[model samples]
Target: MKEIIQINLDNEMDLILAHKRCMKIAEMCGMPSSFQTRFSTAVSEVARCAIAKGKNSLLVLGINIIKSTQKEIVAIITDSEDLKSCNPEAFNYAAKISGHIQYNYFDNQFTTTISQQVLSPGLLTETKIKGFIDYFKYEPPLSPYDEIRKKNIELIALSEKLTESENKYKQLANTIPILICVINERNNVLLVNESLENYLEKPLLTFERKTLTHFIHSADIDNVLEGLKRAKQNRSDYIGETRIKKGTNYIWHLVSITPNKAEDGTFNSWLVYFVDINAQKMIVETLKDNTELKMIQLELESANSQLRFKNKELQQFAYIASHDLQEPLRKIMIMLSRAGADLTEDQKKKFYFDRITLAAGRLSNLITDVLNYSRIENSEQYFEEVDLNKVIEEVLGDLSLIIEEKSAVIKVDQLPKVSGLDIQFRQLFYNLINNALKFNSGNPAVTIGYGDIPNDPNFTGSAEKYDVISVEDNGIGMDSSYSGRIFDMFQRLHERDQYGGNGIGLALCRRIIENHNGLINFSSKPGVGTTFWIYLPKNKRS
Candidate 1:
């Protein structure tokens, strides 16, 4: 078998492209760069000279055998012109590049053949890049007129083949009565028939570096891409829903892809077609809605009932807040009113000063908690990097007196920097640590640490890159059932006097976390320590 590459060296750019194609083939044949340059340069010289003489020169590159065991790269340049008047320098240059040179003259057509021996294991690795080079061969020598006639025969055959291909393609496209397109391996559009262009009410698309995805609805692009991925990954046919624009409306289509591969089993291209399923889809949806109408009505009724119940709960909450606030105010007012003119200094000091001050402080705390809860969503601020470790330090500083009183050992670990409102983070950590200390046993020990999110059943939500901040304490934990409502406002598991919280601390913590685009969760068993896990997105904000 012989290999050949044909080129019409009619222009300098043609010479260049031909040279590149020739060298690529040489490289594919395992020829070194030096040999590649030799073959490409030799062909360039002959091609340019032939073009200069105003002749339709043809160049063919292929494996030409020399001796019994010797095979070399070869370039055969033929033209229907007199070689006697040609520049001798071109042939000389080709001769120097190639080891062998010959001239064949038959019936007024002249040919220049050049061959060079390749080393052992020559062009050991053949490439699939042959399409980049012209592939043609001539076994029997012919005259200039005969060469032209043979070329004419080839041109006729090529024309017929193209016509046949177009006919078959159109037949397939028209028969479908739907949109269809063909794309190359690189997702470049190779063909689109007339029906598709008319259906889209647009000009036929430029058949290069495009796919059906180019015209697909933007919203469905992700789904189409996923389908393409699955098709390639599984190497199977793919069927998916995509929408195509027709005038102002987008019509649904059931897109189907039939992928093709090379002889070497690599992907080649996909023949994609669409079935207009818009009417059918609408029918299916209409049927489904009618069938489920009863269930939907029932669900709506249930939701309305729940909404009313929640409204009642809100009324109860207001009543409770009002009653609680009145008690504290009433205590202060009664204590002050009792300070009569005959009262002793000791009674006046204890009642008017200490009792009034205690009641006022309790009222202030409750108001502050309610205000913070309401402000979570109303206030807006620019996000910034907040140092978790620094926030922890500030919280500990505020609780310094309590820490000393309880002799609590608060261990701080390395914490991550997170993106959020700075003040919110400080309060969030403060609440968790304060609760841990308040609920601790006599010998209080609290551990604050940072960890990757552990795979726990209680954890929910997804943040790809985040930090898990835990405040674990050796405290008297409550029943597991209370964990669900642990963060509810004014929902206390213990008496207010026992825990010393208005039941707003955990709720405030939950609000702050929500503002930071994070989650707060905790776990504990009765008599065991509690661990509140705060998951904050670890964007590099600092």
Candidate 2:
């Protein structure tokens, strides 16, 4: 449902009544006070033009729906003749206030449509507003100039009211907290409030002749000027952030410029507002410094964690070396002591000498494993782009004799180039392949393949994706219970009579993978195959 109000604009009083009626309906429609003034003023201007051209006019007020959930007041002024009078200033001021104005001359009728959104706090009480609405509907129309004498008197009163408004505006400007100033098109200060003086720590008169950019930081002068240029060219407001000079010190502020028009409704000057944002800027700086400090703390914690891990590893190595290294030597000594001159040649050859040789070989292997395990940490420091396929091919070549003797099948897929130590990679592949061949049931066969880490069951982390390289062998695998235990130093599941190993090869692989920030995990079942999955980060040093 919509409401309509009509008023004849034949006299000054009649026109004024039309304006008041339009405003009441616009207010009933919940229009803001500012827009009510604009809409009614635009209605008066259009109705006045029709009367000035010696024509009859009627003003129509109705509630209009602009879009879904949006309603506005629509003011229509229709004239009996196509009036020649047009006031651009009135149209512009109306446009500035309501943001809408339409005029058309057709069918020997000149019509103007002025509209404004009716957004306010409350709905009109129909009973309370009915008297005002009836004023436009029931009043008898008057001559267009019947109240000319009274209009002359009101004009004189309006001149005095204008002077009082200027004083009130100045008083309002002085009371605001932010720095407010008005600058002319020439960029010279036309007026500034008392807040401006407090910001500069000087009297307002001192800034009168200087250009507005004089107080801005040199580095920020261009930005302020650019904002000014854009606001002027576009005839709108613009906001900018910059530092302003407060004597020898600089403080940041949000500078906003709004075009201020003169009485003739042309863009006369810019009303500038400087809102001090120094406290916000200081808070940001403090947060940045705190973030940097937090990052350093995180790095220190990571380094300490690595150091703790290495210390625990060293403790385990000491235990293994102290206990295991002396076993072979003690056995050798015992064999020699028991055979002192009482040993026959056959006994010496079969028992004492052979036992001594076997003990020596075990001792040698133990020492070599210990050295290799320790060297994994210290041997590599710098990294280069390494082709793993080439390294795997080279490892196969090194073990050619063993491969041929065992009649093993070696299948390798194309591998990727990774950022790592090539020597360590070769050692890693060589140890895995050699172990697979040695532990096979009869003939050895190993397959090496690579893929993304997300497909591997061992990866359980966020999407910081990694690459997976798997080495699988169809050899005699151990029980699942020993899957994690096989990587420990000297942790052999099989006796020396069955399998010959110091049990440090897998341990070395674990250290190398740890140094590269990777994971080494294996899945196995007794008498089935075992696959070792190595997960490495795609593009990181640690």
Candidate 3:
């Protein structure tokens, strides 16, 4: 070992000294110059590991001529027992000589061994083919003392470089913004940079060998475990959101973990970084919630505006139709009445009298329906406590003459006392009954039934409200298509001669229910029957 040469492995610049000596060794051995690139790379890596792991260790590099035809360069290293703890996998390191070298770890230290032999005459001749043929021939062979002197000088230079580099890296690792840490496979912290002190408010020594969960907030334990599992299962980068305990306060941190793999593709540990994204997360949540609330407010405003406009248009239409057209219609009716009286009995025959009377009767019904429609529009239909049963009895009484005229069998159920306007609600029931009776062309048995649907859809104003009334009839039922259009004003399914109506009955029913903040929907089939459902607010009295 005394004749052998040794150089400390430290820093990139100091690598040139050992590299220059390796080239000389290769030349003296008569190996082709091509081996120079490979030999230099191998030597530099071995030197680095020896110094990095060998805190108090020394690297012993030696070249010996086994034979005149073959030469070997071997590196022997001795370091603290800590080297035994280092992983045995080899790592590739780059050398300044434009080549890559592999490191093979061993007990107590690692070694990089290079072997070279003299080339044939033909290969040596080809080395001059590219450039620099004369320098190879004139160079003096290196003695053993020269190798030692050169190695010692290089070692001294590398020692100084190692000190400078260590200081520089320590400063850099301290100043970095992200919290960098190295954890063992068991999630125990092996090394943590100084940046972590800001978060934990403690020194790096306190974190050593401590489980990562110690600093993680209790609420974030499950999420952190999930992130670890994901990283291990996927063998890729993992991201996790968690709250970390800093002093007595908790702050959100986004942690990222990347697996460190050995050369054999086995899991060794993880390299992690934690970024403070608490502010960003809070901002995003606030913005999202605020945006959703604003959208709801805008929608409500738009709906209310539309409702007001519709009400105004309805009022204007009703006012104009009632007051503007009534005077002219009255004059026409009086003139027609006088003209008919002047005719004699023979002239005022049955056909002429019937036709004129029928026309006048239709005009009168139309005027009455118009007046009712106008009243529904102008009236305030907000709901209050009202007796629906009493309202039904009254409506039936008004239609008593017609019921007897048709000999109709009217069935009434015990109706509920719900909240709704007296006038509008009474009108709703009246129109529904009238429709059932008038449309009874096929069936003679009139069945008027009312009941409450449990768990009724509540009114928007009072979430506990349910519609309390319904009218189902087995009379001349309408098809599904006509059922949808039944609530439209002026929409009639039959001619005036067949059904005496201005088509405002169902429309008025719908308007009254709407004013009470209720829903009016129905289901009907062509040949089956029809059911008109009115959903009233559960707290109609509220």
Candidate 4:
């Protein structure tokens, strides 16, 4: 007659679930074999009657007794529906019957009560008691109720195994390196692991009163809000990334979320885990910055190149003007000479007419040399495939008169074919030959020769494509002191009158060779002859 169970349920499903809960609870508590089924069934039947007939309320408050001697255990439930809805006479009758049953059992008594107010929307009142039927110890009662109770004991043992499995799962979660947390529908954290406190740098209790927003960075608030809304609304997993602001720095994290639902399939809270990914974020940002820097550098280089080109164009324009002006000056010098020559003996203007004519001729030659130098200086012309030997022969033909006049003993050798501008190459050879013929000490004995030094170790260039072209002479050799400036513009070691020409010839030769991307250099001794060497790169057809 002890108070075992009571319920006041509005829905039949709730009553059923409650009944199952009671049976499971009985199984979990290790109820004795003699009373296991009787206890669970008695509680189920009482709860069913209360919920169906009484107002809607069900409450199983607490367990009060466990008695091995009588094989009896008791729980108390407070229900108020019976007092208001049941007939007073029938209730009194049932109470009397239960009292008689308790007295026949033992000296102890148990009672579970039902009041009218318990059915109302308030707290349920509960009472529990235990009675033992231990007097007939020699032969225990063996009823169908006792057999059902034994099965309940077995079921309880199995449930203990399930609880052990649950503990194992919790242990597994604890072993993970990541932080884990469970939150409720109200956004309140329900459970947090030790790993969560590791990163938080605070105690677990500190997060108890705070919502998820309290730990998140302000800039990421909007994104977090959206993800939270989606998780709760759809009751599905949502994932995203955000940075957690440390003091002055920030730690980036990748968050994964999983949603759980309530018994009624309503929205629940998310199961969240945050993973640190700050290193990867920093690498991506660094690469982006470097790329931007390279682009800026390239743009600056392009601008510098454009400026240099413009400057070159201006210089070329000045050179062209100077070159064109020389023709008129040459003409004026010739006219001045002619007018001087026409002066009469009495005029006194012809006192030095020979000297004047010579001076005018020199001036005219200077103008012609200046114009040629300017034209070559401003030119950006390129070279093509041409035979150097042919260019040399043509230059010799042009200087045939000078060769005959000097009675020069000129000796020539075979030359190689090279990629070069025909006119420039001819000028280059012509200048060198002129210098040799002009500077002869005795009767001209100039020898122009061409030969390659097989794999010349002294030559430092791409061996596969570079070759040296030597123009050697056996004329009056120059002093070592003047050899260095031999290719300088208007730089004459000997006087202009002595050399019978301006000193721009060798300088123009240097320019023409350099324009072909070749080197022009010479070696000389005071008494020995000189040799001018041109090292050029071979052009590939491709």
Best by TM-score: 4
Better of 1 and 2 by lDDT: 2
User: Each candidate's root-mean-square deviation in Å?
Assistant: 23.6, 27.7, 28.1, 39.2
Scored against the true structure, residue 519 in model 4 reaches a CA lDDT of 67
- The residue-by-residue lDDT of candidate 2 on 1-542, one tens digit each, is 24466666777676777777777776666666777787788777777776666367877776665554666677888887654345666556666666688878888888888877757413434343455457544555444453553466469789889989998988888888888888887587878898887778875444114567668887677668877998899998989988888989999999999999889999978899999999998888677877797897898678667867987788688768756776767776676767656877887887667667677777767876786677676322687789998999899999999999999999998888888888889889999999999998788889998875433465564434666788999889889788667888889888889989888999899888876767788887668778888877787653
Per-model TM values vs. the true structure? 0.38, 0.38, 0.38, 0.39
Candidate 2, residue 253: Cα displacement in angstroms equals 36
Once fitted onto the true fold, the runs of candidate 1 whose alpha carbons sit more than 4 angstroms away are 1-358, 460-464, 539-542
Ranking by lDDT: 2, 1, 3, 4
Model 4, stretches more than 4 Å misplaced? 1-320, 344-360, 374-380, 453-465, 539-542
The residue-level lDDT of candidate 1 at 10 comes to 72
lDDT of 4: 0.62
Model 2 steric clash pairs? 10-144, 11-144
lDDT at 196 for candidate 1? Answer: 80
Which 10-residue window of candidate 4 scores lowest in summed lDDT? Answer: 115-124
Candidate that would win on lDDT: 2
For candidate 4, write residues 256-335 as lDDT tens digits. Answer: 87886668976556688878888997787677877797997898678657857986897787667766766676776677
